[model samples]
Target: MKDLSTFFVKDNLDEIVFSNRNKAYGAYALRNEYSSQLTKALFVGVAFFASVAVIPLIVSAFSSDVITDKGHDYGPYILDPVEEIPEIVKVTPASSVPVKVKTVESTIFTPVRDVKKNKPLPTEDDKKDAALSSETSAGEDTKLIVAPPAIKVGPPTVAPPYTPPAKVEDPNIVVDGTKVDVAADFKGGINAFREKVAQNFDTESVDKTGMVSGVITFVVEKDGSISNLKVTGSSSEFNSEAERTVKAIKTKWTPAQLKGKAVRSSFRMPISMKIE
Candidate 1:
């Protein structure tokens, strides 16, 4: 009891507050009690700083810089000894390589001039001479000269002396008319021919009909005289009358001419017996 009472009776303010020991034991004691916590906080800060510095190094070491899910999917791993990859080399073949071209000397093109109307073309002799000169300059192949085929000279045949065709009496001169420049004419014209025919018919007393009709055929000779008096018609009496009438014409006719020369020309006369 005595000890407990004495222990409770504490020292006064002068003894506790005004002590000579400057150190605050309360603060030192408080610090000592939380020392383990302080050491734990300090260790945490040091570990955080180390991770901040080393995390970037670790990320950079693993980063291939590929920016995609593919990069994220790749897990970190120890790298093998890094070696620089050699660049790919393309090899071109000798055939495909371009070659330096060589310049060639060639003749310039020349247009052919138009030939003038007054200028004549080169003759065969001139053409041969030019060809020979070109061949000599160009060292062309030897030319083969082919001789022309021989020309056989034949004698001109002499035509036999031209003999004119013989003049034969034209039996048709009394029938078919001849084409002449000047046609035959009566001595006094066509009226005279009819007058002579009428005069001869008036002398004929033989019986006749108005229906009786015939033609008298004759050829005027080159001498302007009538010949080959023939009769042609349906009625024989009328034919006979026409023939007698034509023969009665004593006047000579004007002969026809073929190319200014007199030619034998045929003549015809129709006769009708008028029975009034």
Candidate 2:
């Protein structure tokens, strides 16, 4: 309750507020020195900022001459005038002259006459030489003559006529069904043969347990007779019965043909049966 009616005071707030209170506390001392401490901090901060901004510019100014002098300078050069070289000339040699060849001389001999034949009147030159004697070493003076062409005579040419080859037949050779032009067939078709096989098969001789299967193979001869009967099966008894069944069929087969001739061909059949 001191005179709070007044708005201004000559004493600072810290001096007055803490005068009667405990000034021994650190808060009172810190409050009293705040203005001076803040002023000192502001001046130190401004000096540090100014040095950061200006130090680089001052160093660059001082070192500019050293940077310029570090590099070497090249002066303008003087070039000598160039002389033009002359072209070289080539020389050619003259050709040599050709030598001439000489010809040899020949002597001609006189001809001899046959005195036994009728003699024609001789000229004065011949008569004078003739009196020299036919015994004189001489030959007949004949001019060069061309002989007539020879005629060639021969027998007329005759070509022999062509004969066709005969067809060879070998009935002993048996060919596969696939190689023949027409495959062999049963008298009443394949199904009829299968039915005949079923009727003729004797099941009593074979084990009827589970499933039994077999393949029967035979060769149908050129004369439509079945030979070389063979059977393959899971059971030996069934195989034997199947072979016997096929052989029982006596009906002749229309034999397979090759080039319109009957040929022996192999045939295969698969037979299977199941009994509980």
Candidate 3:
């Protein structure tokens, strides 16, 4: 009954619950200072937010950023005045214009000459009346004529006839049998050719022929015909008979070759016989 309302004991629930029950504990102390801590944190938060919002405004007010008008300045236009020109008058002649005169060249006339002509012989009557003279007579109306030349009495001198130079022997020429790449050979062979010669040779025609031995030489022509036939031996008749026997063999030969080309080549063969 003693004015309990007027004596209002303001004790929070945490304080009232912790009354005389270990107020020294950390939880109790934290509970008691919670209101003061909350008020201090609120004031600090408001100051931080206010400073953040006002810093840009404070810097802009002190900075000098001058803004000038960017419009271009142009001068007043001055137009140039145009002057009028008068038309020119021209005069032309009604007649055609004359051209310059040119000089003409003249050509000289020349007469052509004709072959020598013989004058007619004077008659006996004319010779009696007029004396013979060497003076030239008037020319005929034809082209300019010349007099005939006088004839010589003796044999006239003649230019010597041109003699042609001697022909040069061909360098790519016929070779001897020893010099040819491939020696000229008879159709069969040298032995076969010799056999034919011995068979055809006339031993009876030879003079004192006992084992007659001779060497016959001939050329194998490009056409494979025998040419330049010659024989050497003691008896002339034996030589002649040997040559005749070799000629009687009608078979052509294989021409000798030098550098793979057919060429004439000299061939030699020794012949022997007995006429007993």
Candidate 4:
């Protein structure tokens, strides 16, 4: 029989552990067979290029919507006399056009006094009673005498319709720094305002890649002069430019009026800087 010391011998341990370097352990061999260095590198390169290409496309799509600034009004173009449209001659009779003729309706209630066709003649007792009543004197203060109720004649003269006093807006009142009555307006209207901006503003530094919305708020003082100019928005890069554009408008505005008096008014104007 083999002894326990023989199984624990150093020679047996060396033969099992240090036999070969080429053949790996079971777990190591499985991992080395499945993994590939070239495959991993290819996957990483594709992901990097995909992310870089997608960014510029997103910017271009969003930039189109952002480039729009507040538009100008073109109300000064009036039609000439030659452009007037004359009235059309009726093809059919005037009666052919379906006219919704309104009918006048009046429902007046009138009391009717009817006389019986077959009234019976008065009896002898009724005749006697009528005679007795007629015989009574006008000066008599008898219990049987009853006076008829006095009736008011004709419709009471309709008193002049009560008119509420006109709503008087106080000029001093400022709602969100603005007057509710006659709002503030540029001297020559919106078109004139746009022309002034285009002629004066410096557009070289403005970016066209993305939309940067901002607001230029200013107070139109009582003397038809502008003051308190400010610029605010999400992008600070354009704030200085917006401030410069609004301040350049040296033209006096028509001051807002409330209660027939000029008042200091605040205006919030949106500034959209786009490459036109």
Candidate 5:
């Protein structure tokens, strides 16, 4: 029994030593892990600071070189020496000799009249007799003088005043044969016709189907009336609507002028229908 107790006691001591060594190793491992983590954190912090500081310095160095090169190519550095070039010499031209021009002389003919000698003065009776004789001689000279024929001028002809033709009234709504006034027949202008058509037009009729555009030709008589209503062209979709609207339009337009007189003239109107 004593020997068995001794063996048990030895085994218990060995177990306690192994347990203590394991705990010491665990503590060392924990310390080494903490130290490693701290070292890594410090290294990371230093690298971050170095990158932030060095990147700007690197960019600054490259930027400085770029600025220097730019100055060499595009800045005032390349222009400073260009202002020192020597000016070119200009030579003066020699004076030209003057040339003399010659003058020519021409003869002109003029008639000269000789002066007659004055007659001696006579007595009063003699002077009266001379005056009567001179009067008879003047009358004889006047009879010898010949007169030129008279020229006749005719009076200028005047043009007749212009009178506007009477306005022709349209007998039928369709206005088939009667001549109509284009400007006077259309009561409202083109703008009025467009407004009326737009106001009365059925949007549903067009929108449900489509749109149609057509050119209508009609004559306006001297008497503010529309005639010869006909569609020149139209789209098939809204042709009926366009025709109806055009027929409904009772536009009174101004009659056309011919040779300064108001006359019936043809007018072309465009009708369009659009669906919203």
Candidate 6:
């Protein structure tokens, strides 16, 4: 009994130590085996893909061949030697056409007479006979008559010469107040005529837009009326209105005065139109 129990090792401790060592060794061996297998599979896959990629290129490098004389033995060939072509001879057909031309007959004509030749002239004896006949015919003429000369007349009388009056400078000739006509002494009364024009204007179409300006020249008589109405200038759009307005004025005008007497005179009027 001295030591049967001591000689018997502890069963649980021995089993625990053996189990841990076995587990560690088995895990390490499994990891080494998996690594070796994975490396081998990767090498095999890469070698297979590389061989597959190079196979077509290697085959293409040796497949192409250029043949010259032996190319015709195959089915069909292109760009063959030019000396093998056969020569072609051209044969022209003989022409069988016959040439034909039309012929026309000619006719000759002759003139009845030759007018260019010269003829003989009358002699001196024939001229002497003709002169004697003319003298005998002149001796049988009728009698002639003559008239006497008339008397001359004297120069006619002349009328008296006309004299033009002296020119006068009048202050009233310039347009001012009620003076609507140009006087004889006035050079140009455009400003005076314009004043009268303002009083004579009449609006026809007030609805119409824009405006028109026109100048009219006419003769003014003894009475206060207008005549010979004519539009000298006007806008194209208002030409009809200008003519109508001028013609509507009275035919008699208060004449311009010179030296305290009414006299015939010329006047001009300018018309303006304004629309609202």
Note each model's CA RMSD in angstroms. Answer: 47.2, 17.3, 25.0, 41.9, 21.6, 21.3
Candidate 1 lDDT (Cα, 0 to 1): 0.70
Worst 10 residues of 3 by lDDT: 136-145
> How well does candidate 6 score on lDDT at residue 161?
90
User: What tens-digit string does per-residue lDDT give for candidate 5 at 101-203?
Assistant: 9979988989889989977655574444343444323222222345889878798878999999998755333332234322343445667777887786665
The models' CA-based lDDT, in order, is 0.70, 0.82, 0.82, 0.70, 0.62, 0.57
Which candidate do you rate higher for TM-score, 3 or 5?
Answer: 3
State the lDDT at 29 in candidate 6.
55
Q: What's the lDDT for residue 104 in model 5?
A: 94
Pairs with steric clashes in candidate 4: none
Q: What is the per-residue lDDT of model 6 for residues 2-54, given as tens digits with 9 covering 90 to 100? A: 35553355434345556656645765456436757899999999999999999
How many clashing pairs in candidate 4? 0
Q: What ranking of all candidate models by TM-score puts the best one first?
A: 2, 3, 1, 4, 5, 6
TM-score of each: 0.37, 0.41, 0.38, 0.35, 0.30, 0.25
Candidate 4 residue runs with Cα over 4 Å from true position: 1-178
What is the alpha-carbon lDDT for the whole of candidate 2? Answer: 0.82
How many Å off is the CA of 274 in candidate 2?
2.0
Q: Write the per-residue lDDT of candidate 3 for residues 229-265, one digit (tens) a residue.
A: 9999888999999889888989999998888888888
After the best TM-score superposition of candidate 3, give how far the Cα of residue 166 lies from its true spot, in angstroms: 21
What local lDDT does model 3 show for residue 216? 94
Query: Which window of ten consecutive residues has the lowest lDDT sum in model 5?
Result: 135-144
Better of 1 and 3 by TM-score: 3
Per-residue lDDT of candidate 1, residues 1-276 (tens digit): 435543454323324553676446675445444757888899999999999999999998998776665545566788799899999999887676777999999999989999868656566755553444423243345555789999889998899999999987553453235466788988789778887777777434546556666677788887878888898877666667677767766788888876676778887777665654
Model 6, which residues run further than 4 Å from truth?
1-208, 250-252
